[model samples]
Target: MPAARESLLDAARTSLARRPWSTVRMVDVAALAGVSRQTLYNEFGGKDGLARSLVRRETDRYLAGAERALAEGGLPAAADWTVTRARENALLRAVLTGCWTEGLPAPAPTAAPSTSPVPAQRRADGPLPTPAEVIALVRDRAVAVLAPATSTAGARATLARDCEVALRLALSCLLAPAGDGGTAGLVREAVAPIPYGAGR
Candidate 1:
């Protein structure tokens, strides 16, 4: 069942690369996955469910990257990792902002509006897990990953606050990218206050 679900998600992802999520159809996904439409429905309940699952999967991937970065054990290392991941994954920026419209070119004026409604779960304001919520989630995960790297009681107490700063700085860099030294400089500035131990 997990493999079948993954296959459907893979098909959906491929379709999404070619077209907007608003236009992706479950039937096409099923066909691409070599499964019956009923099977797709059974697995995901509907398009909205499928979309949520996809978002969750992508979020997990992003967090995994973040965990690996924090495991490297220094503010500078984490900053570099965050910036690199943002550059490599366009989806990460979109997820961080709760808006997926970035990087996509505006549709031609003559193009017809999609007949399909935007998923009801997604609103004009934005998607689930607002930017603040996402930042908090990332900060919490980062603190956990970085906790072992900190030695002093003072460092542990301040780790969460420091992570919040780091994540916010990274998001800012992603939204308004700086040239060459700009992002690295900003990251260093953000992490300057965070305490770290040797060999971490």
Candidate 2:
């Protein structure tokens, strides 16, 4: 059997995966993990702490995957950049979709979901890649993928930015919510200009 902390963490992950993070409570987590509330508190320092740990754990996994993708050439190499952005979207999506405002309040030990009535300071709806960051990630990786493609300094910069946009669009498509059309539409619009197999 997993240790208490591990059990609690796994329970939190499972619960969050099913319901919004705001819906999950420490009592619920303890019940699901088959541990005592005190055990959860002792290990996680309460709900917000647990949520932070969950985010950190997921972030670590994403970074590990990104590093590995960088090592392996091909689309997977570019996948490093895509995966980081995808993970951020997933986290943000969760916060946005799972909020409790006019309800009886979220279960104890957890902070009200970040997307509650107060609203998230960092809103979910925005440019997928923020343009600049994606441009940099792609440009740095481009030398490896686009070394053979002839281009002057200005041309290479333009190509890199376009490729980053293309990547962001692809990820947005892949990670779109099952029913939501916004991400899908954004992806379609963004990808129309970039040609594939042009970089690799």
Candidate 3:
């Protein structure tokens, strides 16, 4: 009776909570959701399709909150990143990491490393983007989103950078310990100029 997307999301969330992203099976999600495997395939096409939907759903929620807060000058932008950082914190990371919660013991602790091992740390060989460079990108995208004067190319570049920064921030939030708040302050700082200047 639920909408197809909501039903799919509910099933996907349950499966993700039980196991790592790689191990989650579409069949399991369909079973949990009470939908036939054919229906699941018809709706989502595949696991990758479902993952993208999940990402978009989560991102849409965050963006809605950001839009609401952005009304108070550029403060909303800062608030948006802060909220996003909190959502991506250790708790979410633990879920993402495929470690067991209180329930779902059959999977077992020794089922295999839930996440991939990182390659040896290495220095960057190319020109590195400074935080300011990253911020400029955020600003450009915000302008394109909020202001009609900014050109599409300018906005596209900025949007791309914002995405890059968001990924880095997500990683930091997931890896860092509690109370650190990850790179929230940095994201806030980066996002501030957009809303503040747009109203000028």
Candidate 4:
């Protein structure tokens, strides 16, 4: 089922890239995934559910990548990852910035209860994160991984502020383009303990 689910999602993503989400046919998606329409329905509950799941999957991957970057190279690397990902993915960029352009499927938050038996679908049916929430989520993740156990309350608070600033800087880089190296250098400067403080 997991493999089938991923196949359906992959097909959907390819279809989305080719045309508008509005014109994407469920039957086509099912055929592309090599599953029946009823299987798609059982997996996703419907198109709205599929949309939510798609967004949720991207959001999860985005956060996972940020966490990995943070673990590997701290806040600046995470910022670099953020800028890179947002630049490459229109849906993710829109999700991060709260800007949904034409032809994109922007999944709205649902007030109705989810009755999907699928665990992933049920989670997807839950409230999706807004742009602000995405920022805070990434910032908090940075703090969680980067914060030292011995750091004081004030130190952790300062770290949180710095993480938020670095993340926002990444977002800014999306709105305003950077050089060939993209956000790495700019993010490194912003997250530096003492930016531009001394000669090399």
Provide the TM-score for each candidate, comma-separated.
Answer: 0.74, 0.47, 0.47, 0.92
What are the per-residue Cα lDDT tens digits for candidate 2 across 8-114? 77888788767777677889999999989987776655676666555545434544444445445333344434544555555522322233332212323332333
Which has the better TM-score: candidate 3, or candidate 4? 4
Instruction: List the RMSD of every prediction in angstroms.
Output: 7.4, 9.7, 11.4, 3.2
Instruction: Please report, in order, the local distance difference test score of every candidate based on alpha carbons.
Output: 0.64, 0.50, 0.47, 0.82
* Candidate 3: worst-modelled 10 consecutive residues by lDDT: 116-125
Q: Between the candidate structures 1 and 2, which one is better when assessed by lDDT?
A: 1
**Where in model 3 is the C-alpha error above 4 Å?**
72-141, 144-200
Using TM-score, rank the candidates from best to worst.
4, 1, 2, 3
Question: What TM value does model 3 have?
Answer: 0.47
lDDT of 4: 0.82
lDDT of 1 by residue, 41-140 (tens): 7776677667766665666677777777677655455656677776775555676765567333222212332222333213211344656887777677
**Residue 156 in candidate 4 has what lDDT?**
74
Task: Pick the winner on TM-score between candidates 1 and 3.
Answer: 1
- Model 2 regions lying over 4 Å from their true place: 1-3, 74-167, 174-200
Off by over 4 Å in 1: 87-90, 102-128, 149-153, 197-200
lDDT, candidate 2, at 197: 32
